[model samples]
Target: MTSLLFVDDETKLLRILSSYFTKKGFVVHTASTGEEARSKLRDADARIIFLDLRLSDATGIELLQEFVPRYPNKLFVIMTAYSDVESAVTAMKAGAFDYVSKPAKMDELEIIIRRACEWLDMKQENRTLKEKISKMMQDQEMIGVSPAMKRVFRMVERAAETDATVLLEGESGTGKSRIARMIHRWSDRKNQPFVSVNCAALPEQLLESELFGYEKGAFTGAHAKRKGKFEAARNGTIFLDEIGEISLPLQAKLLQVVQEKSFMPLGSNQTVHVDVRIIAATNRDLKTMVEEGLFREDLYYRLNIIDIFIPPLRERKEDIPPLIEQFLDKQRAKYNKPFTLPPELIDRLVEYPWPGNVRELENAVERAVVLCRDEQLSIEDFPREIRHAKPDRPPSDIALDPTKSLPEQLESIEKKLILDALEQTGGQIAAAARLLSISRQRLMYKMNKYSIR
Candidate 1:
C-alpha cells in the first residue's frame, strides 16, 4: 500500500485528512509538530508527505531542505493559506513537489497524489531502461575475436552467473578494469553499486580507511563518520585493482572480509557485515608473491577461486583490427568527422607490437584522428616509435619453404625471430623486448602464448 504523511499544526485538519486518505486506501500518518513529523517519517517511510508551510516548531521549507537530499525518491507537497501563497512558492523552490493553498479541496489533493505516483513510476521505468542500455553499450565496447579472447569471454559469462570471487590476472593496460565492470553488469547485482579501488594507488593506512571506512573522530582529521568502499558496494561488487600491491598486513584484514564477509571500521568495534561480491585484478602474479612472502596465501587462495587470465593485445593479434575500428568509430563520432585509415597504415598497426596493449592502440587511433589534416590518416600521424618501427624480420630474410601453408610459414618466421632476439639479448626479457620494439610484458605474454620458455 502507498503511504501518505501530513505534517500540520492543526489536529482537527490532520484527523480529517487522515481519515479521508485512509478511506482512499492509503496508509496515512499525521504529525502536529516538526519533531513528531520526523519521528513519524522514520517509522512510516512515507512515499508522499503533505507538509504545512507553517509548522508548530519549524517551517515546511526547513524540513523540505533536510528531507529532499536524504529521501530523493519521496515527494513533498506543501500546504499553505491562500494569503501564504508566496510562502508556498518558496517552499516549492526549496524542494516541495507541489503546493496547495489552504482549505485544499479533496479533489485537488487526489489529483496531485495521482500525478506524484505516476511521476515516481515513470522515473523508475526510465532508470531501469537506462541501466539496460548502459549494459548493452558495454557489451558492444568489448571487441575481441581471437581464441584467447573467446576463452576469456566464456570465462566471464560463467563467472557472471555466480557469486564466486574472481581474480583477473593480466598485464597493465590489458583492460582488466573493463572486464571487471562487464562482470558486474552481467551479474545478478547489476542494479547495485560497483565500487572500484586501486590498491596500488594509495598508502596502506589511507587504503585501510578507504576500504573499511571510519567513525567520526577515528583519527586526527576524521571529523565525520564515513562509509567505506565495502559499505558503499553493499550488495553489489567491489573491484580491488592491483591487489598485489596491498601490504601483507592489509591482506590479512582483507582476508577477514573475504572469508567472513564482515569487517570493523576504523575506531569502531562494531563489525559491519556486507553482502558484497569481491572481484580483484592484478598485473603481478599473486601466487608468486605469496611464495615470496609478499602476499598472503589464504587471501590468494580465496581470491583465486575463479581465476581469469586476460591475454595481452600482442597475444591476441586478431582482435587488433576490430579494436582499432571501434576506437576509430568513437573518435569519428566524437570529432563529428569521417576519418579514414589506409590499408597500409592498418596493416602496419596490425603488425606493430602494441607494448601498452589495447590502451595504447586506442590512444594511437585517437591521436591519428585528431592530428590527421585530411580525411585519410597517414603513417606520419602516428607516434615516432610506431612510425619508425621496422618489422622483426622481412619475409625474404626468413627462410620460407614452398611446401608449407602461409600461416605455417608465418608461424615459423615468428618463432625464429623470437629465438634470435632471445639469443641476441642473452635471455634478458627486457633487453629482448627492447630489441623487438615491444614491451617486456608483451614479450613475456608472447613467450607464454607460443610456449617459447
Candidate 2:
C-alpha cells in the first residue's frame, strides 16, 4: 500500500488531512513540527510527503533541500498559508514535487498524489527493465556494433525464425556463444530455456552423460538420475560450444541424436525422445577435422543448415563507439559514479587490433571504470599493457623487460601501459579494463597500488 506523511503546525489541518488520506485508501501519518516530521519520516516507509512551509521551527524549503537528496525517490508537496506565490515557486525549485496554499483543495491534492504514485511506479519499472536488458546482454558474452557484427545480427534474426540447426564458426573469443544466445532470444522458443554445454570442457564419457543424461547407476559417481542438456533444453535451444573438440565416437553418437531427435541414457534401455533445436559453435576448422577422419561429415552437414561466422574484433573497428557507450552507461549505474569518456579515446580504440575480440574490449572498459578516480576518465586510468600498446612496435617492445631488476622495470612498463590504454580508450575505465584483460575491480586495486595517476 502507498504511504503518505502530512506535516502541519495546525493540529486541525493535520488531523483532517490525515483522515481524508486514510479514508482514500492511503496509510497516513501526521506530524506538527519539523523535528517530529523528520522522526516520523525516518520510522515510516512513506512514498509521498506533505510538508507545511510554516513549520513551528523550520521552513519547508529548508527541510525539502535536506530531504530530497536523502530520499530522491520519494515525492514531496509543499503547503503554505502565506499568500506569497514566490515562496511556492522557490519550494518547487528546491525539489518539492508541487506546492499547495493553506486551506488545501481536496480534489487537487488527491490528483497530485495519484500522479506522483504513477510517476514513481514508472521510474521503478524503467529501472527493472534496464537491469533485465543489461543482464541479458551481459550473458551474450560479446560486445560490438561494427558492420561485421551488424551482419552477424541479421544472420541471428534469420536463423531464429526457422527450426534449422545453426553452426557458428569463429576463432575463440569471437563471440560464437553470444551469437547462439542472440538466436535463442529472437526465436519462437525465447520464453523457453537455452541450455549450453561446452564440448571441449569435458571427457567423452562425462560429455555423453552431460548431453544425454544417465541413470543413477550409469557411472561410479552417479548418485542420482540426471537430466542432460537435451532434456533440459526440451522445446528450446541447445547450444553445443566448442563442438570441434568432441571425440570421434562421441561425434557419431551426437550425429545420431541430431538426425533422430532422440537418445537413450548411458545405462538405460529406454529411449528418450526430445524436441530440441541444436545451435552448435566451434573455433576449429571442422572441414579439416572431417578430412582427418576426426569429425563426422554427416554431423557437420546437419549443423551447417544455417551457418553464422562472427568476425574478430580486429576486423570490425567501427563498432567500438556504441560498445563503449553501452559499457560506460552500465558501469556508471553499477558503481553509482559519474564519469564520461573523451572523444580522443575512441580514435585510439579503433586503431588497436583486438586479438581477443569483443570479450577483450569489454574487459578493458570494465578496468577503466573501476580505476578511474576523477569525474572524467582520462588516459591515466587504463592498464599498463593497454596504455603502452603501440601499433607499429614489435612484440618485444610490448613485452615486459626482464633485464632491469624485474620489479622496477615492471612498474615502469605498467605505468606506460596504463597511460597508453587510458589515452586510447578516451578515459573509459571499462574500455581500458578490457584492453588490459583484467577485471575492473582488479584494475582499480593496481591503480591504487602503483599510484598510476
Candidate 3:
C-alpha cells in the first residue's frame, strides 16, 4: 500500500483530507509540524508526501530540500498557496515531484498523486540501472564462454532452483555479488525486494544494528523504529557481500537468523521472524578465517551449504574478448556514440594480465570511452598500465578484417588460442590454464563454455 503524507498546520484541512483518503483506500498520515511529519514519514514508510506551502515550523520549500535527498525512495509534492505561487516553483527546483495549488479538488489531487508515484518509480529504476552497469562497480551481465564459466553456470543453476543459503566465493571484481543477483532473479522470489549490504562497509556494532534494525530508544539517534534489510527483504533475498569481513560477535547473531529465521532488533528482546533467503558472497576464505579464530565455524558451515566459486579474470583469458566487447557496446549505448576497437588494441587487451579482473577491464573501457574521439580505439586510448603491460600470449589476429563485431573477432582469436594451448600442453587442463595464465577450474569451465573438450 502507498502511504501518503500530508503536512499542514491547518488541523481542519488535515482532518478533512485524511478522512477522504482513508475512505478512498489509501493509508493517510497527517502531521501538524515539520518534526512530526519527519517521524511519520519514517514510520509510515511513506512514498509520497504533500506539504503545505506555509508550515508553522518552516516553509514547505525548506522541508522539500531537507527530505528529498535524505529519502531518495520518497517523493515530495509541494502544496503552495495561490498568492505565494512562486514558492511552488522554488520547491520544484528543489526536487519536488510536483506542485499543486492550495485549493486542489479531490479528483485533481488524486490524479497528481498517481503521476507522482509513477515518476518516482521511473527515476528510481533508471538510477538503479546506471549504478548496475556503471562498469566501475558491480551489477549483472556475466560475459564468458570458457569452461570455467560453464561450471559457474551449472552451480548457479542448481543454487537458483532451491531456497538454500548460497555462498559465492571469489576475489573482488570476479563478479561474486552479481552471481548472487542472478540467483535471486532465477528464484521464485524474483518479484520481492532484493536487498544487498556490504558487510565490510560498516563497523561491528553498527553493522549488527543495520542488519537487525533497532527499536525506538534502542540507542542514540533511534528517534523511530526502523526495519532492517532482512525485514525489508522478507519473502525475497538479502545478499551479504563481503560476509567474511564481519566481526565474530555479529557472526553469531547472523547464525541465529539463518538457523531460526528470527532475530531481535537492537535493545529489544522481542524477536522478529523473517522469511528471507540469505545469499552471501566473500572474497576471503572463511575456512582459513575459522582456523585463525576470526570467523565463526557454525556460521561458515551454514553459509557454505551451496558454494559457487568464481575464478579471477587472469585465470580465464579466453573470457576477456567478450567482456571487452560487452563493455564497448554498453559504453556506446550509454553515451550514444559510435565506438570501434582496433585490432592491435584487442590483441593488447587480451594479452595483458588483468590483475583487477572484469572490474578493471570495465574501468579501462569506461576510461577509453571518456577520452576517445577517434573512429576507432587504439592502445593509446587505454590506461598506461594496460598499454605498457607485457603480454603473456602472442598477439591475436582479431583485426585481419574490420567487418566483424568485437565479440565475433574476439571469439575467433580466443578459439585459436585455446586450440594452440591444448595442442601445446597435450590436452592437459592445468598446463593449458598455466600457459594461458588462467586457473585450472576456469580452463575446465571455458572448455565447456566453448566446447573445447
Regions more than 4 Å wrong, model 3? 1-140, 393-453
TM-score of 3: 0.57
* Residue 377 alpha-carbon offset, candidate 2, angstroms: 2.3
**Comparison by TM-score, 1 against 3, better one:** 1
Per-residue lDDT of 1-453 in model 3, one digit per residue for the tens?
Answer: 778999999999999999999898889999999989888977887788998878888888888888988998887888777786567667767887666677778886887777666767867755644443343224435766677876786687678899999999998999887788888876899899999999989998789888999999998989999888899999999999999898877888899999999999998999899999999999998999999999898999999899999999988888898788888888888988888897778877878888888899999999998888675787788899987888686675445668888887778788788889999866755457668976545667778878887
| Best model per lDDT | 1
- Residue by residue across 214-309, what tens digits does model 1's lDDT show? 999999999999999999999999999999999988999999999999999999999999999999999998878988999999999999999999
Model 1 lDDT, residue 422, Cα: 94
Q: Report the C-alpha displacement of residue 247, candidate 1, in angstroms.
A: 0.4
- Among all windows of 10 consecutive residues in model 3, the one with the lowest summed lDDT is 131-140
Error of 2 at 376 (Å): 2.3
Could you give the C-alpha RMSD of every candidate to the true structure, in order shown? 26.0, 18.0, 23.9
Number of the predicted model whose TM-score against the real structure is largest: 1
What lDDT score is found at residue 427 in candidate 3? 76
Q: Model 3: how large is the Cα RMSD against the reference? A: 23.9
